[model samples]
Target chain A: MTVIEKVSEHFRVMLGQKKEEHLGTITDLMIKRYALAIGDDNPLYSDREYARKRGYEDIIAPPNMVASIVDWSVGLKEEDLHEDGTPKTGGILPSNIQGIRVMGGGEMKKFINPIVAGTDVYVTTEVIDTHVKEGKKGPIAFLVIKNTFKDAKGKIYCISERTVIAR
Target chain B: MSNTQPLQVVYSEVEIGEELPILKKNTSPLQLFRYSAITWNTHRIHFDKEYALKEGYPNILVHSHLHGAFLTQLCTDWMGDRGELKSLEVNIKRFAIPGETLTCKGTVVEKKMVDGEGLVTIDLKEINEQAEVCAPGRAVIKLPLV
Candidate 1:
């Protein structure tokens, strides 16, 4: 199928196909590892005592760290797993345009609460919109998807809009 | 990565166009491993140099989250104890490979009040040694209204 044809087909199949999961609790290891990777020396992400002294109950994650909390075990819970987790049928990508290069075009987010270590992180993702534009070289697809992250109790921490571009 | 000056920021005392302290760090291959391990990102492009070469990159590419992390650090460093980051969104423009010195900078773009609380918006950027923009981001922060 042509790129346009494939994208149109995928769009219909993906409309409102929301996927969510209990990605498990946030751990100090996850927080500190992320902090260390970025070489951040902020105590709020490392020292529990320091965070408490600063008014947080536990070590709080850096705001942007929320994006890295996906369950990597390749063993997502049944409910959290989509009907087909394969790249061809899942997670926002349009199948049949396999040869195109994909890039993260941009992101927009709104944070409502802070996510602290030990709070179970949950994320729900779905397609909000999609647009096909003609680029300098050819047609490009901008897949706009929104992912909401919250603690297991349902208190939202943040909502992010990710724009994935395919050329 | 050892340490730096203490962070001290208050909303009312700050002004628009004020610049935050610059955050500079050299990314290493090992640091990339830690980032991938922590985030559970098994993408070969982040860690495998051969794969990167096949894709026409000079070296292993820095994870996009790493760029966002640096941008986030800049915002939090300015916020200090009296403020909190409300939101951050970044657009990755170029690939920052391991060992390049990346600098993060920000400027306060707007300040306002919501429900008796102070808020500030910042325009953020991360550039490589060559000074090319790698990731450009924006952040909204909530500050104490003392």
Candidate 2:
């Protein structure tokens, strides 16, 4: 089978599969690091007092934080890692397609609500669809997955549909 | 229970053609490492230069998610204290590396009053120092009617 055909076969089986878990919670240090790493010193994400003055009890996380969820709340065990250093599991996107190149370029995001530090987040991910198309490189497979993040209080912070291209 | 936007932008005062102040940030190897660290991303292309070269990259590649962070900075910084970012859609058009300067700029495309909040839409772009478009996107922002 061609690479795309093999990958597509795998993706079709995974479609509609849903994984639900308490992925992780936002934290002050994590928020600050994320902000500084992006070189954004916006007080909204870094200073508690500034956030309080703005009527927030604590610092807020960058809006995109939910979409970048990288680990379980506790920690990522060694077994969860791939040889290349990327997390091997948890994401709805298909993994371990030998001889196929996969690239995640960007996202289609909807920030339903702002996320704050210290919020316990739960996530539900489902593989929504998959399709194949010819590209400049070769036949490209677009795997689309939807992720929804809700706080412990049941407030939805963000929902995203990300596209991962595998060729 | 609702947080106002970061900017004190009055809904009626904003015009469709208004441009948000450009948000620019410089990238380097260290900052990229920090981003990857915080996100638990261990993609070798972001940290291992030699491996990146073998993968045919000139240097370590900046995380695609980092581009999302840069775009997020542009909106939150521009909205200031009273504008809420209701939604944002960013799609990367190219890969950017460290030592490149990425700038986020957006133009107001539509404005309206919906559900008692002033909502505006923007067409956004993240461009590298070389004048190449790296990511292009759109956002929906809610502003205070007051």
Candidate 3:
């Protein structure tokens, strides 16, 4: 069987399967770095007094920060990285598809609450849907993954539905 | 420093079909590197030009989430401190390389009062230097009613 077919076979069976992860605490430095990377000078992400004036308890993360972070782990060794520089595990897809090119198609995100600095964050990821479509090259697989980010008290911070394409 | 005290957007003043001020960004290689570092994204296509060429791209490509970030910034900047982004949706239609100019633009589409709060829906898009629509998106924001 072809590699795409093999990966699809595995993903088809993974539909509705969910994985939960503890993303650790949201830090002020992390929030500041993300805003800086985006070139966003919004004080809400950095100025605690400004955030408080805006009704938040403290500095808050950018709305897309949690969803955009690819890995929350400490570190990964170079030898363990795929040729493409992606991690061997913790990706949205099965490890068997490591060599295949993966790209983001799009995302739909809902912001439920502000993620304050010092809040412990957790994520629950689930494979909501999978399909194959004919592309210019060949058959491409589309995986729709849903990620729910919440705090320790079970208050949802954000829910994102993202489509990942494998070709 | 320019937006340290952003203008507050009042819901009563917002008009339907009004175009938002454009936010233009030219992704530098350094910016892309910082973005990858901060997000812990080690995807080679975003940084390694040789690998990106081997994968059929002209140069290192921009991160998809970066497009989302630009769109989100457009919304937040327009709404200012008094407004909150409730939801945002974006579809990346094309790949963009570093050093290309990407412009984020949006138009207010609908307005409503939900639970006495002003909610505005906007149609958002990012255009490349070639005038190609790289990413199209939408956002719902809650603005303070004054």
Q: Which one wins by DockQ: 1 or 3?
A: 3
DockQ of 1: 0.56
Q: Which is the winner by lDDT between candidate 1 and candidate 2?
A: 2
Model 3, position A73, has a per-residue lDDT of: 88
- The true-versus-predicted C-alpha distance at residue A52 of model 3, in Å, is 2.1
How would you encode candidate 3's per-residue C-alpha lDDT over A73-122 as one tens digit per residue? 87689887788988777665566665578899999999998899999999
True contacts kept of each: 0.68, 0.72, 0.85
Candidate 3 docking quality: incorrect, acceptable, medium or high: medium
Candidate number of the best DockQ: 3
Candidate 1 fnat reads 0.68
Per-candidate TM equals 0.89, 0.92, 0.95
The positional error of residue B87 in candidate 1, measured at the CA in angstroms, is 1.1
Which prediction has the highest lDDT against the true structure? 3
lDDT of 3 by residue, B17-118 (tens): 999999999998889999999989899999999999999899998899999999999998899877889999999999999889999999999999998989
Residue A153 CA displacement from its true place in model 2, Å: 4.0
Model 3 chain A, TM-score vs. native: 0.94
Off by over 4 Å in 2: A73-83, A87-96, B1-7
